[model samples]
Target: MNQPASLPLAESLLAAPLPAGGPAWLDAARREHRAAFAAGGLPDTRIEAWKYTALRGLAQRRFADGDAAAAARGVDVAAFALPGVEGPRLVFVNGVFRADLSALEALPAGVSLQPLSQALRGDAEPLRFALSRPALVGHGREAGDAFAQINAARAADGVVLRVAAHAKSIAPVRLVFVGAAADAELAWHARNVIELGEGAELDLVEQHVSLGEQAQLATLVSDIELGDHARLRHVVVQDAAAGANLIRRSGLRLHARAQATLHVLELGGALVRHDLRAELVGDGAQFHTRGVFMPHGRQHIDTQLAIRHQALDTTSSSHWRGVAGDRARGVFRGAIVVAPGADGSDANLSNKNLLLSPAAEIDTKPELEIYADEVKAAHGATVGQLDERSLFYLRSRGIPLGEARALLTAAFCRAMLDDLPNAVLREHLSGLLIAQLPA
Candidate 1:
């Protein structure tokens, strides 16, 4: 079959030369994944996993490989800093690591943090198992998507973090990805690997921001593993430029007695999609997540979440909220599955959405599949506008109609930030949520 003309991005990427000078195995793996992507091309809406998000627009756009001047890009360091988050930080501009802008001098004794490119330079053997995995296999079938294949083949730099056994970090580690304006449209790929040893505890924050309005294509693939009794608190804030298109996939695995909690805020981008999949592979494992996505103007945001219970007595819970205004659109899918023989598993998911304009749209889907005995699973979703009575009451108190609407919308979205442990950070996030509403 001839490659379609709509897929110029894939064709252009396939024609570019691969990265030079790596281990023979690394080179071979990149070639194999690139071949797989070339054979499959970009997936269409016909695929069940991609029904709500279409790539035809993205496919028609062509992008340069990366920003060669990323290191020289003048970015104000103070712009992307967060309150009460003064710790080890890794900064990347246009998917390239910047040593001068990054702060990695005084990392904790047991914590090892560095960019993937640096780790690959010396003793690349330690990362072989992760970097060499087939892109289209395992992990709830979400990891096998076309974007994952692209990242596996083209990603040259990202974050590599490790925490030793029984060690706890008092401060949170931050990973910042900043998109800067380039002379031409660009495409970048990044791969992140994070592991926590047994009995270790850590807090991680990941942020995506842009220096200015620039049309760019970016793909990120992250693999996280939590050992027995390890605990992780993960937070993500996505506030890219309105012209940027960002796609990301994250896979997490929890072992015995491991607990992982996630808080995410999606508030920017022209077109954005996130695929998050988690596996509870050990007894007594727990996973909890809360997120909010607000797409205003003409932006489109989609989030796909899947959780699988593969062990006895595992528990999982998810709560997500969405608000779309103007002509924007939002999509959310939460799916949970319990394998046979995984008894005593409990899973729950709830998704609520609000439409702020007649032209706005929100799609919410909640699915549950249970083959195990003694399992308790529940899922629900709702799409509607704000209550008229609440708005009326506020307006009667002398508040203008627009102010009342903004107040109600802010309150609706701030519910997702109530449980954040850091007071300063939580307040900052709440302020950002309120700022995102139309005034």
Candidate 2:
């Protein structure tokens, strides 16, 4: 039983591990990422990217893996069962994608689904290419982030989705991160890569829910690449319980004239962090991201969004809203950067938070860095309690106090979810909002 005296747990988690067999260069990269994942941020203070997270003393609770199959009972997946949700849905229990338990009936043409492990060995060229590309570069590197590195090193499992060019599927593809387990209750790591071909269109709903009672440590990383003129509508749902360690990071790249709009909703988890990024790498493209997080109890939720405008005539917008209740802690950081020569670029980033309890904590940051003077960019942050006038109006209308509060809170998040291209997903997510949020 030895502690690193003054060293921070966050830093320790970044250090390197043993190397893997890959191309020499790739192996070197993996080794480097491994070490980085094992290293630390000395003292694990508020100075790093994890400042607003539950980083202190994390070393004392190193994230571990849980029972592979025993966690199905504890998670709240039963709450989301409803009619009209279509297509093949793959459920991953504790980071292991379960194809046998998935439903892929009536899937559309050109739609191929493979587990990450299966894809890596069979027709995995595209996925391998995408995985090899580092989302973090130069000063843009959260590249040094251990969580990302750890995800990279241990990313042998998870989900892989491939859509062909000019194909369209009405069925919503679901990648459910099921967190139910029994003994050996610990952590799970998931690596997912989704590829959309030129002129392809798809709607995807990603559900993250814990299934069992043991403290679940889950880390998920996704890389999405959009081909020319492609369209994708994505909804990310995070609704863990009061005692789960969740870390998720997604990196997206957009090509010419391609458009992708994403809606993110988070309601639970003891400790949660999301590192989401959208890169506009092509001309005449647009990336829109919207998110709402409502955490109750003593939960901690942190969302960091960075959108890079890498080409000309590209537009990006991000709006994040959160309602913190009980003794919850909420953190939001939204950043937009217009790279040099990315002229005619337009970007807007905003974060708004509502604190419902005296003990609730909220931290919000909106950052805009523009290397191009011609780009139109703006950033704003706001934090406050519910509007008293609105509360009074609800009460005057004979609404119960709790009902009115919940209604108002739900309304604040609707703008972020209602715009989802998939009507079914939008409604399902809306229902999940009230279902997951605490009264």
Worst 10 residues of 2 by lDDT: 1-10
Q: Which pairs of residues clash in candidate 1, taking residues 3 or more apart in a chain or in different chains?
A: none
lDDT of 2 by residue, 300-402 (tens): 8889888999999999988889888888889898888899989999998888888888999999888888898678888899999778899999999999988
lDDT of 1 by residue, 324-414 (tens): 9999999998999998878999999999999999999998889999999999999999999999999999999999999999898888888
* Residue 341, candidate 1: C-alpha displacement in angstroms: 1.9
lDDT for model 2: 0.74
In order, candidate lDDTs are: 0.90, 0.74
C-alpha RMSD (angstroms) for model 2: 3.7
Off by over 4 Å in 1: 1-6, 137-144
Clashes of 1: 0
State how far residue 285 of model 2 sits from its true place (Å): 1.0
Measured by TM-score, the strongest candidate is 1
